[model samples]
Target: MDSALAVRALDESTWAAFAELVEANNGVWGGCWCVGFHVKLGKGRTAAQNRAEKEQRVRDGETHAALVFDGDRCLGWCQFGSPDELPEIKSRRLYEKGLTTLPDWRITCFFTGKGLRGRGVADAALGGAIAEISRLGGGVVEGYPEETDDRKVSGSFLHTGPMAAFEKHGFTRTRPISPHRWVVTRTVA
Candidate 1:
């Protein structure tokens, strides 16, 4: 971790920094605004609309994310919320195939700046999210991270994050969700 790294929750004061980071990355997964898991997918929405929706959620205090910062620059973030807050999983059927229960919170996605990819930004963000969740009230938090063997995976495809990062933060793998992804969890205390 960078010595200057700091983490903060997404709120009005930090919304601009978050927005700038997303905008720089071409709106984050084709102008997603990190809303793909929050709402239904494929609603034929434009990038601007997605941005508006995300901004509204932040303004309404209906979203949660741990934004990582290096001084004034926003490096990345980890998106997390209650199960109801983020219900749209990409592999829904597979994710629920053998599921018996839902977690108190889900760490759905992570994003690091374009130029800062391999600098432990996502790891720091994950740690921050865990700490924030713990402060709110300890509970079982779940995450879906990609499991890469000796194969190469694109950075965009690893948005959920890499399995190793989660494990490094004390998350344990529960089961496989997809061919290259696994359901991992950690009980914050």
Candidate 2:
């Protein structure tokens, strides 16, 4: 056995590990439950609701993510889904301004354990995501990654991960959806 982080689909079987990671991280981004991209969290949206709905989606196979695990403990996850499955995104106005075609899969967000920051967890989660996408019938995959080259970006805002991380995994820049965020794409086959 390679004592390496393995990627597993965010299904019912792995829901416990995923939930544990989320719980440890304050439900992730103010109790988002990693569902911000799937559903808009307006005012009054409680964390409990997010968790419940997220679990339902997982059971229904409506949610998709690659959960990264070291041994049996989940360390992080890379969320990816169809455009319709993950419609709500950052920079929506800019992201949709020049939209022509939708990628088969959208890499929405990534969350790592609190103690594992600045490590290779994000990269591993992304690699896991691409591999999972390939296993699900490869096609055009897109990610909205922030370019962290010139300035110091707080890790708290890197839910979508960084550009260089995606680049090493074969994703190329398609366009700039925001000042520092680039719409990166790759054909995973």
Candidate 3:
């Protein structure tokens, strides 16, 4: 992999690259297209439907993500948006149970290209997402990442990313949403 990866905001101009990455990753977890956290789940939409809707959302400016690219190839992404923009999330039952205030933005998922894990792509995607958030008017940001310390969680199940990824990016644990899932919060100025 090239060490000179650049981060780009997912938008109309960058949609193709984003699509390519998703398609290459088997629609990102059973053809999810990373839409599982963006809308109500169990909708029974096919991969094709998910792709179409995701593209429409991008055109409508209803979705958000930071795409990492190695030249023209998208290596991965970190999906983030307003709570309303990303209403669904992991451990929702417990997440809202202790919710006091909703974050200005929520990082719902991450995806790295095949054989690209451990190459800092996700970390870069996270930083890129925060930078994009700041550019879009900085505000309170939050994410749910698993506490992977001392545990060997498969990368496939780490769509929410790892706790270390958030902590190093300045997010702090606000509360534990589940046994392994923690709500991390940080304010971007």
Candidate 4:
């Protein structure tokens, strides 16, 4: 971890910083505002609409994220929420097919700054999420990370994070959801 890295929960006061980071990254996967997995997929929504929805969700305290910062600059974030809060997953059908128990929290997405990729920012965000969840009360924290050991992968496809990172944090692979994605989890204490 970077000694200068700091992590904070996303709240009203920190919303601006989060927004700035997303905007700098070209609205994050085409103006997603990090809400693609939070809500149902809808068509004909513009980037502005998505931004407005995300802002409202933040104001309403409906969104959860571990925001990573380097001094005054927002570098990255890890998104998490309850199953009800984030009902949709990338491979929903496959994940649900093997679902037996619901997790207390789910890590849905991760993002680092454009030029700051592979700089341990995502690790800081993951640690922050675990710490925040533990502070709230420890429970089973789930994550969906891609297993890309055999071939090289791009940073964009690794938005959910690499499986090795989750494993380093003591998250065990529960099941394989897709060809390269697996459901990994850890009990925060």
At residue 117, what lDDT does model 1 achieve? 76
Candidate 4 least-lDDT 10 residues? 37-46
The 10 consecutive residues of candidate 2 with the worst lDDT sum are: 1-10
Report every candidate's CA lDDT.
Answer: 0.91, 0.90, 0.90, 0.91
**How big is the positional error of residue 95 in model 3, measured in Å on the Cα after superposition?**
0.8
**Model 3 misplaced regions, further than 4 Å:** none
Order candidates by TM-score, high to low.
Answer: 1, 4, 3, 2
Tens-digit per-residue lDDT, 25-105, candidate 2 = 899988999999999999999999999999999999999998888889999989999999999999989989978999999
- Indicate the TM-score of model 3: 0.96
Give per-residue lDDT, candidate 3, residue 160.
95
Estimate the TM-score of every prediction: 0.97, 0.96, 0.96, 0.97
Tens digits of per-residue lDDT, candidate 1, 1-189, equal: 788899999999999999999999999988899999898758688889889999999999889999999998899999999999899886788889968899999999999988897777898999999999999897999999999886899988899988989999999999997899999989998
C-alpha RMSD values across all candidates? 0.9, 1.7, 1.3, 1.0
Q: After superposition, how far is residue 53 of candidate 1 from its true place, in Å?
A: 0.8
> What is the Å distance of residue 125 in model 4 from its true position?
0.2
Candidate 2: where is the Cα deviation over 4 Å?
1-3
